[model samples]
Target: MPDLAQSTFILPQDATLTSEQSALEQRIWAFINDNHNTTSTHLLIISGDAGAGKSVVLDAAFAQLQKAARATSGELAGTDNKLLVNHNEMLKIYKEIAGTKSYFRKKDFMKPTPFINAYRKAGKRADVVLIDEGHLLLTMPDPYNKFRGHNQLADILQLARVVVLVFDFHQLVKLKSFWTPALLKRVTRDYAVTHYHLTEQMRVGDAAVNDWIDHFVRGKMLPLPHPQHFDFQVFSDGQPMYDLIQRRDAETGLSRMVATADYPFTVLGGKTWYVQAGSLRLPWDKINFTDRPWAQRPETLHEVGSIYTIQGFDLNYAGVILGPSLGYDPSKDRLTVDLAQYQDKEAFKKRPDLADTTDAKAAIIMNAINILLKRAKHGLYLYAADPALRQRLLQLAK
Candidate 1:
């Protein structure tokens, strides 16, 4: 977890940011200053793939916002600002960070559903609501998740004068949170809009290696990068990959082994489930109850991580098992996904707009791998379960 903790440390204050650094600052302030009976919410949608510093930007914005809210006198004085994120593990981390700061409070960081429900019930609106990981916001009603609204973002927009969302559509994993640019445009059709795409990658700092991962995620299997500083290993077997991950963890902690959703496991089934590959056997990460995140816990070394556990968190190193749903096409020189082989049925739940098309399903699967592969800040170790994929990847490394 030190790997993640190292990344989450708050950076320089916005007040100290250089003129060249504040790309989103001017627009953020304009919306705050130009508020005069906004019939439609002023929408600031910031998009980036994972590791693009969206969360860090949102955190900096929130810091400045809270300071403004605490100001003695001004147009911005005594204004309310709340930060929201749909992911529970991330929410917990935010709260933990708040615990150390006197000015920050846990109540200020909240899940979207409760924030929306409370505001609607009280007939009030927030001044500025910054949503981190906004892509995880529910697109449809889900009682199990306690989100009964038709759409969470739409609801938040109604409940806030200005909504700043840190989003990445590629991070969409579940059908409940299915989103596309078209859908986003439809949602904000009438809003006064400002948008930004963060291109600077923060976690995976090696650009060449990062590009190689990007190509693979998009189905173009190219030669693995040969960056002298970044470690990229292709394992023909799983056990050796696991061993390397352990060594890396022992050296620097917070390195992990994760897998694609190509194996079967049920939530709350009263039975332990395992992910096995050639002498490498480990249980799926159990439902975490402790305050620590799945990656932070010491016991998780024996458990294989999932997209749910690893997303939005950085690792010192990541040992990834590309499960059976994926194959390498040596002839096509790319990756292929078999939706039928994917075990995460929850991700393929019905979406009215998407219907039964496998395109969305395939993209979701690839996106999961993309997020998994990007979690490592220092290195990435890969093991493909499909023999053809393993061989192809190994050949490319040579």
Candidate 2:
């Protein structure tokens, strides 16, 4: 599917960004323009909180680069193969670029294709390489030495002349770094970073709503207004939330129903459900149907769409379960969610309770929730068992 079709990639431009964000974007542009003439190794890492316009700026910058490179095609300094890593949108770009129905279904291992092996070998330089949700590129191994994903993009990272990694620190899930403080730390230490903090949020309609999500993602999120169409409501009886979910669910009829780390069912009626992976496999014979197709009876459940899947997707209604993952941490003097276990298999083996750090996971979870909730043409519903959680919801809606 195309990134435009995906809910995550198709960002709505409803609100204007703040002066700070605009300044940051200009600075980044200047840096790129200044280095546009340089032949030295150019790597730019753009980091921001979720909902900040990293992708938005990237879209504009990429378009400019494509225009410039195309204008100076033959006389330019680099190859015509401008490699772009589109995550879920990769297939879309390839289809559009090739302008044909092409599928990688063949089992032949040796013979390489033009589109397939653009960056297959080392010293294979390209005008530029762009990676989205870039944190996924970093995958370190545990003591077991097991690999994460088969596509070891080490070659692509090393080969690209001008490589750009765009991502949010809050969304770092199961990153692999060798003795680094955090994924961002590793990147900043390695490259001549041109930091751009995207503060103005265009996702949530209200400034208060943006602030709520920002705080959930980072510890402290300031209030910033957004454009219209971004609106939300938190319901106590589940009626408001459920009704909204049902409407959207009726439209799609749960065909794209998904499970999350939170619950057994991908979606109940309209609202998406989530549960910790550890809890799903408990002795009660609790099975996880997350990311799987919907089953007939209780044993069959819908699959949880990864953050990448929902990047450009949205739901009519979204229900979030705090479960045992999040709690009030006195040390932080704020809500603390332990999400370290969500992606760490080894850590899960040691401490099972940290499996669902609800607070830490809140922003990403809620961001996913927003992906679903914003799909509503009419309304949105939110439910949290904890009273404080419920109150927080009220604050967001108001």
Candidate 3:
């Protein structure tokens, strides 16, 4: 049994809150303050699209709440609040950003069953639980969880009085995710539910590029008119694309090559299989979670990244590879997904539960690709393994 109580919470860097974020924070705070002593549970859902500053807002708000708890010795005082997240990389990033400030107890949402069991054994429940990236919450039992549960959200609700979930619907890329808005509403029907929407574009540097990314992800195949400020481009060759990413990384800081999980991955002597496209072969990034994280480590620049590794963070330049799974049909002038060629075994394993039909599987793949496409802050570089898609992108570039 892992010690759930022996964790430290770090506030994210650049903890400044926007006006909209501040308003949402106040609402959540008011709910926590009002319901801390009550026998009733409350649920607050903060909804936003990617780069809408959900994490920043939530981090800042939690810090303030913790401070208030200490100053006035209110209802939150001595309360065992926990910050829950699905990814370890994301937690590490939060710790890096926060430095030394203590926020709350932190735990992975995937291990909820164990945590809940421990709490039940101890005869206690957390007063407040803040779930970051709540969309990644898993419902199915995996190797890590031996306890039975139908939905993670329901289990979490049983463990905390005031549950704060910060999530984006589009970010639910995993097959086992059961945190849909409809499901959330259904599960939290008895609790006091409050919703807040964040709409500002904070990550992407170019608004036009961001709009194009939105339309692209939504299956709108309209040709993108070239933007003046954004450094978006398509490469016919993979070597030059990799070189460009390297140059950008050296100059402007974070730049990475991200691709859909199209190729088969194999670990040979602790090294990931090299991604190959004709003569351009590059080693895929090592699966670094602890010691050296994927985003912060400089050596990761030499390898390719996936949606899982780079989703929550922003990069200066993103070199995107649309693998064989996704293609462009010149005749139809539309993007197409080949479910048969999709190589992400874990994602495909959950296909039966996530999507019953072929079309549904394709849509899921497109969503994954969309996440990779939107990771770039100032620039987007592209290379499609499918020849037709490559040609189509080149045409659009012209």
Candidate 4:
């Protein structure tokens, strides 16, 4: 297997931080400096919505911490003393900004028994661990992870002296993800936990567009009262929407098509179902891992991506396909989800209390759609799979 820490990509230094980001960076530094030599563990949770600039703040902090560690000739004055874990694509971005020497996946850090055993064998423990997309941290045990812990968060807290987690609870789209306020409090009972919030929008510039997105994602059936600066459109068909995206990509770059897993497809054997919008037929792209970037690849333009591939990334324009699973009630003027048409197998697994109830399932589907809708920075082009829904969107567009 290839070493995960080694990367050739480097992020440009021109990314500027907003005021909120600058304040958060100072606080993170203060937290690290205060707890540098603490015997017990400390946890700092930075919570923010999408486009809140968590990654940018952390990237800047990482660079500063690295510089500080280099200047000091102490036990923690090196890269090995700190560890950074995130999704593969996120880590790649960080690698470009900070370089690759201390990167690991969340799964690798969650196997506490093995991680600790190896560390003990080497006679060292990590001083700090930085986690991005902390909501995506898994709690479920699998064949590869035989860790003796309740969840990944617990295991990570045990392995490091100080842990910094950047998370957004709303982005919890997976079944096994273990990020809730109650869960966080329960797991961090033994550690000193500090919470910080990031509020400024960094990805989408228009506040009206953000508000409209929030309203739509919350299952509002009302028509969007057009925003001033954002460019949002609803198309009757998918081909024109895709054409707009392709044109935008050619002109400005970072535009792609994404959708929910409403169609039938095989994960293995490289089989895929086509998303048809009138004369348009496009293959749905399989779920790509954190290491493999679907949106950044040129071939992805010809494919439709799911929430898994496009989440945590920003685009200039996004062409979204609201598949058959999600529908519109013309009589009620509200959004509805058909549980039967929903095809995300992992999302179908429900908690014992919510078993057999469509409420939870519907919420997940809506959340997935919300995430897809908010991905575009400057523009959003949408096409509903159901004719009724398409007609409704068209009426709203007019």
Q: Please, what are the lDDT tens digits per residue for candidate 3 over residues 227-322?
A: 776788889988899899999988987788878888878544775676765446777766675633475577788888887788777777888887
Judge candidate 4 at residue 270 and give its lDDT: 66
In terms of TM-score, how similar is model 1 to the real structure? 0.93
Which residue pairs collide in model 3, if any? none
Off by over 4 Å in 1: 1-4, 7-22, 25-30, 36-39
The deviation in Å at residue 242 for candidate 4 is 0.7
lDDT of every model, 2 decimals: 0.83, 0.42, 0.72, 0.71
Candidate 1 per-residue lDDT over residues 125-161, each given as its tens digit: 9888989989899899888877887889889989888
Q: Which of candidates 1 and 3 is the stronger one according to lDDT?
A: 1
Candidate 4 residue lDDT tens string, 1-398? 22222111222345456778889999998999889688899999999878777867776676677666665575447534443543555544544333344432223232234554466567675777777777777655533344444477787787778888888867777655634577778888989999999988866757877887787777666565577767789988788888999999899777898887887776778667877765678998866654546677777889988877777777788888888987877677777789899788776655553335455566668778877887877888888888888888888777
| Candidate number of the best lDDT | 1
Per-residue error for 391 in candidate 3, Å, reads 0.6
lDDT of 2 by residue, 224-292 (tens): 233365435555643344444445555643312232244334222554444332222211112333422
Model 1 accuracy (lDDT, Cα): 0.83
User: Model 2 residue 243 lDDT?
Assistant: 46
